[model samples]
Target: MCISRRNESLNVAGTMRRGVCLAGCALLCAFSACTMGPNFDAPPAPRAERIEHGEPVADVMDAAGAAQRFSNDATLSRDWWTTFGSAAVDRAVTDALVANPTLASAQAALRESEDDMRAGAGVFYPQIDASFGASRQKYSPLRVGSGQPPVIFNLFTLSAQVSYALDIWGGERRSLEALRAQTDAQRHALAAAYLTLSANVVNTMIAYAAYGDEIAATREMIALVGEQVSVTHSQFTAGVAAYSAVLTLENEKATLEATVPALEQRREQAGNLLAALSGSMPSQWIAPEVSLENIVLPAVLPRAVSSELVRQRPDIRQAEAALHVASARIGVATANLFPSVTLTAGGGYGNRSMNALLSQTGQAWSAAADVTAPLFHGGTLWFERRAAIDAYDQARAVYDQVVLAAFEQVADTLRALENDAHTLDADARALATSEEALRLVQAEYEAGTVGYLSILVADAQRHQARIAWLQGVAQRLQDTVALYAALGGGWYGNADG
Candidate 1:
């Protein structure tokens, strides 16, 4: 500042110049405090906006009907996976929540974000430090006494200096805000990870259950095929049935026997996967032998409106929070282009003698505001601003994708539930018909009218029916899990921002 003395000849131009400088400083402070980058406008919900039309399923089915009824309900039950009503299944899900590696990893990330928030917030507070040290120094002869005598001295420093950023430009404030948003996002991420873990545990349990039924069906078919072979052998020995009939019976038994190993292999594989999900050693973990056929599927499912996903789904909210952080970052980068003002004031007392350190003569005090403006940079500031704008655009796109993907998953799960239930019902009917057909074939063979081969073919049809029914049961269970995940119901369902 060109401080012309008050007594000197002060002109209008001089007064105007000082006024302009003050005004410019004030404006810089104001602009630097501004949020410069693209503001985070929440992405539009095109699919959810027309949810009534957006839903792909007709409301006639029980699954869609439940969804229509609970559109506004919160939390959707923490044990959504346990709706299957099996104590064993409930135990499995609980174990996974406690032991799953993925959830542990996500939890660690959330803790890290919390630390980031603390570190960022620390910038707003004053920093105080004290230094104490003892040193012996030798005075230079030429400087002290003109080569008369060298003096040995002991020195120590024990002063506390406190400094604070003042947040005059609000840059630190904006940065801290960004960190807080990131912490929220990390929390949501933890919730989403939990949802995934729960779904996997449930799905793996169902898969193991289905394989159990397949194993039983295959064994039953093999035994029945053995019975038919024995019947053929007796007839041929009695000179009633042909050698070709016996050959056919042997081939059917062989095919049934082949199915046993494949079914057992699949069951073992499912058990191994379940062990992994539960974070247990496969060598030590043994999945319970459960039948898919006996497991009761949920009669009613939780459903909610499209907008409910934005509030409930952790992944979508995580994405939205991340966008908020990114938007705040733009303000941080923009603040760098303006002058920064920091106000600092401190007072202290010191002396060579400890007793005199408390005297007024040793007292010192100071107060001043340091104003700094950017003099030069190699286009770093401009590029950073442009980058902030680009980051906002990227974050917006990610938010949109997260929302759309969540909506699409819900639509897909609902459709699967409808279709799989219809299929399971049809397969049940087919099983009944197949059993009846075998009965008829057995009666005809007993009357000596139809060949034993006819009974063997009927047995094959019965086995196929049982396999199909078991597969349908498995599909229906997986569809249920999919629906729960698709709706984005998890830990965040009860979370309040």
Candidate 2:
């Protein structure tokens, strides 16, 4: 009997030592184990060797007398708007960045995503909980065959418990990785918002300035037409010009006057849009006065390479981060198919008398380990894993689509800018010819060498040419803004900007 008892004691000691060693090894393995899942790597470079758009040629056409050349490999500053050399433009963008609701929302979303990632990291450590309880119970001595009266008793308990999941298969690590990728995606999205907001403010301001100039030019035309109408009516009264000629002059004057209201209306609309973009009510906001003459176009524009474009564009980077997150999720789903091992330990003191709970003799302790495996779940785990894989494939396709669209935008902007220069040159030439024609005819009419109708014809043509030229100039300016936006708002760095 003595030998048996000694053997039992040895066996119990051996079990306790093995349990401790096993827990220690699990902790070490948790720290050292590799994460399961296909590791995320940056997508490979596009196959195409060069940008599909034509290479930046020399300054071919002078747009509004402001010529520009594309300089490849130049570093674009984050404050690209300041390059326009317009104080009003710079101020407008600054205000919008500070006040815009969309940008604020995006920034808030980024912060939330980062916090979620931080929370997910807690899974790497153990979970601990403290608990206390007090209860009244009745003892059942009759069931125990003690043949004694049942007694009401008070039970008090206090305990602390600890649990940890050994990440042998790396599900928790993959979950954290996925969350980190999501945070990265939100950060890129915020950058994209900044780029978009700034670009919109700049473009809107350009239109506002153009509309103001157009309205002024229209008023000038109205004045000229009014003078031409008086001269034609006097000629008709003298019987030297037909009444129809006077009617034509009157009609031209009215038409010119009519355009003024439309231009004014458009200018007002632009102001209202600027108000919203700057995050204010129209009544409370004042749009800056801008004109083609006052705004300076960039003389040397930076051009990024196709490969660099993917790296610089925020949307592309955002999409790539999403892809990484999707890829990581597949590992999380796959890990669910395997067994989950959990270790739990608890210790506490309990006694029928609350005061006796402090005694060492009332102390108790317990440790347990649990392993759960999916034996049958109606194929749910299998389908979920498959769904995760499909989701990853979908993300890959979407990433490819984003890259293609980004390149397409860059190409469109390049072509628009190239064409704008030529169009501006043509418009400028037409304006010069129209002004000369009007000049000669007006001088002749004053000298009584040409009929009043000749002056009316010249004025009409000159009015159209001036307005067209103004529109062309505005197009060139807006296109420059477009190029900046297409290049992903000039975002690029090793870390968050």
Candidate 3:
């Protein structure tokens, strides 16, 4: 009867122990689901549909003969630079993307962020580790008042340990969330780098071509002025013109010649920039001969609404990711205010002899659950939470500022395009009128109806008009490039490509 009663008591104790374990597990799970701090939501897109408050972008057409059309519904190609229709430009951009060290650095940073996040994820699983050790130790029972003899022994141990810090308040989870957001920020940074690099390459190419064109036009002006100088000298020799008239023509020719060197210097600088962009020394690579006339301006430019612009720009996206990280950090800080629970289990074999370490007689094991709660920290935890909140607010403000800046840039580029077209149209008309006047003056001079001075004035006016026209053409092309860049260079659609 006593044996049966003892057996029943043992069964009751076992049931109670099982109940305690089950209750502990249930508590852990329930607490783990409660994540601290405010959840994050993306800011709403701007309400204004139009990028600019003024006239519709679509109505603004290029009036300089080649009408540039803006299409709201058209999709921008990922390889937007290709729209310029220059194979050399396409090749340059491709080479830059492949070989630029800055791009490679950004890519490497992105990979590092991803790897860090992966490592942080390990906290979600139990960490298991195995270890082996051997040590010589001396033991004395006299230290504990047992009055036994001291003994020296060699100890051998082999063990496996498992531990997991319960994410009861979601601190570790929030940390992981922050890491993931950081990874996202890195990804956007890489995109921003790619966009910036391509735009720089194209802009440098355009500048190089424009400078070349301007130099050629200046040389033509110099030649025209030289001819006038010869005419004035002949008139002076015939005693029909003053010496000052010849001097004036000579001065004009010298001024026009002076400009060529400066223009040549600018052209060389642009070429060197192109070589650098292509990840090569100027000595190793020469910029291709990309003429202003060869570059085909894109006719149909893609125009995105304000909402889409927010989504498309890498800077905006990166700002958003930063906001996300800040939000997650707030959670992490809040969770820090609560208790952390860590569960550990260890099983080992130990013996004086290495061969006997694995024997059942030498077996040992342990299991424990530790709970550490912050009782007081001199307001450190509380202030940290406040700091995280401040950081989140700061990130949110930065995000708003970034969005505003992006809109401002797009609006400004759009206006510049419209103005460029108008300026180009006016400059073309001016050039034509000046050319006609010069032609008439030359005819009159040949017929002996006008003096060489009249021809000189007309030629100078035509030269000025030609320079203005060339500038207008280059400006229009550059503004077109700006519009493409302002629209985020279609990196979103062409990220993989």
Candidate 4:
């Protein structure tokens, strides 16, 4: 009989172990079940070899006479501003990245999203809570059909409870997924902010330098014209020329002088903008002097194909992340239409006497499983699911628009760079011709072979040509900066490190 009883106990123990194993397998299978929405796939990139459709982005012989080549497979550096070879430009970018309020706001947003995602992840695990209580109660047993006297008693309770809302339809998981995608979008947004701030700083600096150069060129022209006015005034006094000649030269000088204040104003505005970008008050900050001569045109500009640009550009990536978030929201809404399961278990000690609360007789335990199914919600769940689907469609459309805009911007910059090269070449030649003509005319006047009016006409032409050439140089540099920006400013490298 003892042997038979021991064998039966062994069989019962085996059955219990098998039951536990089966329960564990069932839980695992439930967790691995379908997530209730269409999985997201990234939109395929455009099937083009180059960004621009017409002539390839060719080497630009810019105003500085440097050949700026667009390399299809060049590794773009994170600190692209440094490629300008100006320490001042690099310093300004670094300072802006560190202190710009816009960038700081983006960083804070990213951190908040990340924290929310992490907090959302806790739903996958059981929620455990502990509680302790002490209270005085009056009990009346007569209500339970017993004629016992009413008694007042002290009750003490200590308990721990655990509850978990199982993600049977993956609603919670999908919610967490949406949070993660939103975090990703914010990260890309931060990158876009960095790109924009750096590009703005560099472009503004370029303008400041160009305006200063133009001001200098105008002053030199004014001096030359003033010299002519002195000579013409002497000639008028000697009765060798009309007084109108002196008036004409003086008028030209005054017109040239009038442009100086305007140029100075623009230069000051650019400086103030730079100070703001660097997170300093304009009155408290002075921008470093950046000369066009000190700025180096990038020799080999990095170019990405259409397929690569979608991935490189932060705006495109942010759009993709938004699409992902919308897709996940659809799953969450769809999951809400189905039943949700929750498992709860609690154990506690309770007693009228505080010292007896820990006794086995006072110990109690309970377990429960609950299933909540949506029955009648006035079609709210159904309409919500449809709305999520519509939102996903909207996100997809927006993503397509962002991608198209990115490609267009890149194409426009490429064309601008190419045209800038041709334009600068023409301007340089024009300036050179004007200078030669002025020199020749001045020499002829000294040799008594040409009239003073000839020199005046030549000087005016030289002044216009000089201004044009300076503008061309500045435009080429700024457009080079634009190309870098259009290519996403190499933020990926910075993000990785």
Candidate 5:
């Protein structure tokens, strides 16, 4: 039978012959099963040194130091500013979070990067679209069937289409990985910015507090010196003291008077900075007044441990993430070497007559698939791959530098903590000695047995010793803060998760 012969030929051509279409499908299946690029693997973690120098090389403070340990929580929190334990500091931080312009800008950047990452991921899926259109055409009336009109009827078409580039080589997947890494990098970046902002807020507050304290102290000193100067003038006029001595006393009073304005100016500058951090008016918000008497160091401070630092430092994490992004880019570049298959399919129905619009006989459909392979391009793809390699190398270098810097920071902070402990002890001793000497000199001056210069020198020594003691305390506090920063903790509120 003719029907049976046609069926036999159809089966032979489609099944026995297995032409290019079938072969292409098989090849595509193979491609889909095999990724063309390298698989991503994380780099080895760095081996860090165990002990930092100057960390009680002897066994004296072993028990004291061992009681405190740094945390290894992967995610730091939003309220790191409360570590200072000051309500005013808490309020200031809240204000900054709410209104600080720089933070707002950084937040916007984070959001943009997050959206970009989402978009990059979304592209991996198949794209689908639906469209509808209608049109009318005109024909030459004289040439068309001799009895036909000049105008042609309207036709309408509606259809849905879908297309997807098979990510056979994991090219798109790697691109998504790169985007994900970028998102985390931005997250870490935002964390670093927040940390810096908190530090600035605290530093400004500390400066303001110290400046105010110094101003009050200087004012008292000035008033006392002025009184001393008046008393000395009376003694000189009464022939009890030399005129030159009164002039010297007057000069000292004048110098003390000058310090008041300088301290006030510093206080004002600190206030302005605090205002900026709080994103509020300097005059309206009172900078929380603090003093050496009020500051309470942690009962025990956590020591810097290398393992803890590497795991917690936002900067180091950010650098590592950058490396990830770069590594993914190599995959992206390698993927470009393979061929691309773009599947485009669009089908629609059209009918000139309104009554035939719903008829299957008048419907039309179409589908197509395209494959493109790069033949030659002056080695542009090669250069792109090379550039990707270069970027990976650069990221590696930056990661190396960041980790090295972290180690160095811890080492230096350890050295500073050791030295500052000694400095505080020495300053304490010096202050005590100066105070005793000042008391003895004042007694001798009241008895008229010592020269004014002796009393003046003793007073100067006491004042200098007092100021140095306060400054040393402030330095130690700041140094301690820095030590915690090096350890990647402390200013971080104690809420570890």
Candidate 6:
């Protein structure tokens, strides 16, 4: 009964010791939980409230019946390409988003950065390991002056150990912050990729339409020149017009014809570019026929505030994220100036005989604390910390540059559209006057009141006016598309979805 009581008493003492150990560990954790370093703060806003340029005019006077206006309250949809209301453009953008390797690459990079952040979070927990070993070795007691014989013995050891680095300096936290910021940067990069890809697809489609218009205009001019050549030949054969007039008509026809092949080649090149942007070979993809007439210009364009522009632009957001990462790295560097603390604990059971490995008498345990601090590294750490600060400053400058560029893009697009509207209006007027002049010259030539040269000049002027009008219309449409792209492609809040 006394032996049983003694064993119970030993058990109580062992439990008390373990309880004390756990309590001490808890106290240490509570005391060392604070991290040392500068906490992160968001960068300040720009001093200016509005953009450098004045606000654009509300409505533009277009030659076509469709007039476009700007509205400060207008908001762009997530799929801004759809605003053009062209099924072909929508399909091209959709297909590119699904199959473009560049977007897939960006997505993979974002996943990798997120995984790296997750891995860094592990620094908050303890590292635990279990080990087991068995060995046969010879030992001599004679070295201890016991005069014991040398003997071979079998030994076994089993242990589980845990070690934890206390984040008293907040180095791990700052490192994790940097990693998380990188993940954020990658996410923004992916959004930027999406924006770029969609814009390319839309821009390529617009160019294809422009090329088609030019080709059509060239064909019309060729037909008109052919008619003039036929008239000139008939008059020359009848001796009513000089042979030199016939020759001039023929030469003019040849000049107009020469432009057709170049226009066709340009059209084909634009088509090939569209195919490439769609992630298919030119031979495999059939580019859709597009024209400015089929595209609906957004009646009311969205013009965001300058500050909102900074928030919406993906490249600018990406640059800001990079700056955030640099700032966090400064904290990490500063934390390195402090000492690191680690706690270790281990327990094991062992015996020469495998059957007695778990015996109560064969158990062993240990606990320890350690500290390490860098004494010197030739000023590397100090300079690195300064370098981190400098890098952050650089990132901030780059972010500002990106914002400025984004605003510039919007301004350029707006001015182009405004100028295009005025040009289109003038082109329409010129074309009408040229057509009227051509009709009067044709009547006069038939009535023998004017020479064949007068008809040719009128026809050539009218053809040029027609081509100029087509080009002006196409340019206006392209600038409308550019405005959409400049405004962040309407993807600020919807990229993750």
Please report, as a residue range, the 10-residue window in candidate 6 with the lowest summed lDDT: 43-52
Residue 61's lDDT in candidate 1: 52
**Candidate 4, clashing residue pairs?**
none
- What are the clashing pairs of model 2? none
lDDT of 1 by residue, 1-497 (tens): 34765435477768889999978876776766544434556665454443333445554454312222234333577678766777778888887788888888899999999999998888777777655545678877887448667777664434566776656556677798899899999998988888888888888888888878787878888887788888888989999989998898789778878888887888788788878888899997777656664566766566657756787888888998989988888888877876776767666666555556567876777777788888789989878978987888898899889887877788777777778767877887888899999999999999998987688779878988989988977887888788888777555565653
Q: In terms of TM-score, which candidate is strongest?
A: 3
lDDT of every model, 2 decimals: 0.76, 0.85, 0.87, 0.88, 0.71, 0.81
Off by over 4 Å in 4: 1-32, 53-64, 142-149, 445-460, 493-497
lDDT tens readout by residue for model 2, 73-98 = 55667788888899999989998999
lDDT of 3: 0.87
Q: Candidate 2: where is the Cα deviation over 4 Å? A: 1-32, 53-61, 142-146, 442-448, 451-460, 493-497
TM accuracy, model 2 = 0.89
What lDDT score is found at residue 279 in candidate 6? Answer: 76
Note each model's CA RMSD in angstroms. 6.2, 8.5, 8.7, 9.5, 8.9, 11.4
Reference-based TM-score, model 4: 0.89
What ordering of candidates by lDDT runs from best to worst?
4, 3, 2, 6, 1, 5
Model 3 C-alpha lDDT per residue in residues 87-136, reported as the tens digit of each score: 88898899899889899999999999999999999999999999999999
TM-score of each: 0.85, 0.89, 0.90, 0.89, 0.82, 0.85
lDDT of 6 by residue, 238-261 (tens): 988788977877787788788888
Candidates 3 and 5 compared: the better one by lDDT is: 3
